[model samples]
Target: MRLELSTMRRVQRNPPCDHIIRLFEWFYTEDQVILIMERPPNSVTLFEFIKHSKGHPTERAAKVIVRQIIVALHHCNVCGVHHNHTHLRNILINRDTLQLKLIDFGGARLIAETPSEERTLGAVSRETAVRSGCECLYRVLCALIKGIPFWIRLSRECTDLLQELKNDRTWNTLENILDHAWFKEASTVNRGERN
Candidate 1:
């Protein structure tokens, strides 16, 4: 079995975390490997979720979802799994419950051994792994809040944080991301609500 699948299996065996979708079963075949994953009910892609909300969902809603995303990535960091593909479409949100599930490990990697810098894939160090994950997280958050991609008028804190992420001013690691002031923004009102 590949590191990706084995890592997934290890995660599934550990304590349950709602942030990540569970992988029920997996087995290798001569040609291809088969993986059976859990499908969260009443869930839609974050892309669809944003579309239904019309551009951007309330900052509070986005914060909640983004926090969940951070938690999921943090979980991956602890498990030594790097989800290189952290895009809007890769996350699923329950329409009613507002729960989130980070899905699609197709581009995921296990951070067991340090690959040569020449290897063009997941980050090498744990910090860099989570940092890379956060990089993608911010990109997705940008699209989620901006309603398009690489854009936002959401909030000053959010704008600053996004800029810092791009500029590498802050740690850019997932832990620092969770501790960011923007991430701590309380859900008070939906400034971007539109009808």
Candidate 2:
């Protein structure tokens, strides 16, 4: 498990996301692996924040958090990595600035050209159907927009994106996805609705 975590962490470092904690260093001791990670002051988990506030967050706050999460996911997918365990609990917020950061990549997997036949729930194999970057982007875009749970979402997206990537030559980039008109419209709509 520790080895898996370390691999995921390494993969995460390749394409760092502003919404993710920066992993600075790692070392192995006699019995434990020391992962030196950035420590954000006044940070709290999204679950904690929601709990303290009771149920959902304020509309303004939720929008901010959600946007940050989507940005993080976009980066991960674009980097050919899948963070298969994203949820409120995995999100951390800096209380002072209300900035969001994603934590825990234990479930992350590198996207590979050949999809592995090894099958298991919550397990990722390298074999993906999509062979093109654009198709992968489109699949990831759809997943982000849908707000699907991380575990089930990645597998589905991987299969779909692999197909799309093979067939489509054009795919949206993270910046474009973030700046898409649909997202802007959704943000506007969400902003208007109070928790």
On lDDT, the leading prediction is: 1
State the TM-score for model 2. Answer: 0.59
Candidate 1 Cα errors over 4 Å, as ranges:
54-56, 112-123, 148-153, 170-172, 185-195
What is candidate 1's lDDT per residue for 1-195, written digit by digit as tens?
Answer: 375686676556567678998988788889778988888999999888877874446666667787898888888877767777788888999988789998887777766455563265544567667678767767876766675333424666667767877776646457667777777646233443552
In model 2, state the lDDT of residue 184: 56
Each prediction's Cα lDDT score? 0.73, 0.55
Model 1's alpha-carbon lDDT is: 0.73
TM-score for all models, in order of appearance: 0.80, 0.59
Scored against the true structure, residue 44 in model 1 reaches a CA lDDT of: 95
Name the best candidate (by TM-score): 1
Model 1 Cα shift for residue 195 (angstroms): 16
lDDT (0-100) at residue 92 of candidate 1? 91
Residue-level lDDT of model 2, residues 1-195, one tens digit each, is 574455456546655678877778778788877777788888888666655653333334544555676677667655556666666677788876779887787766655434342343333432231222244344433433344333322333234433544566343443443453334543333322334
Candidate 1 local Cα displacement, residue 89, angstroms:
1.8
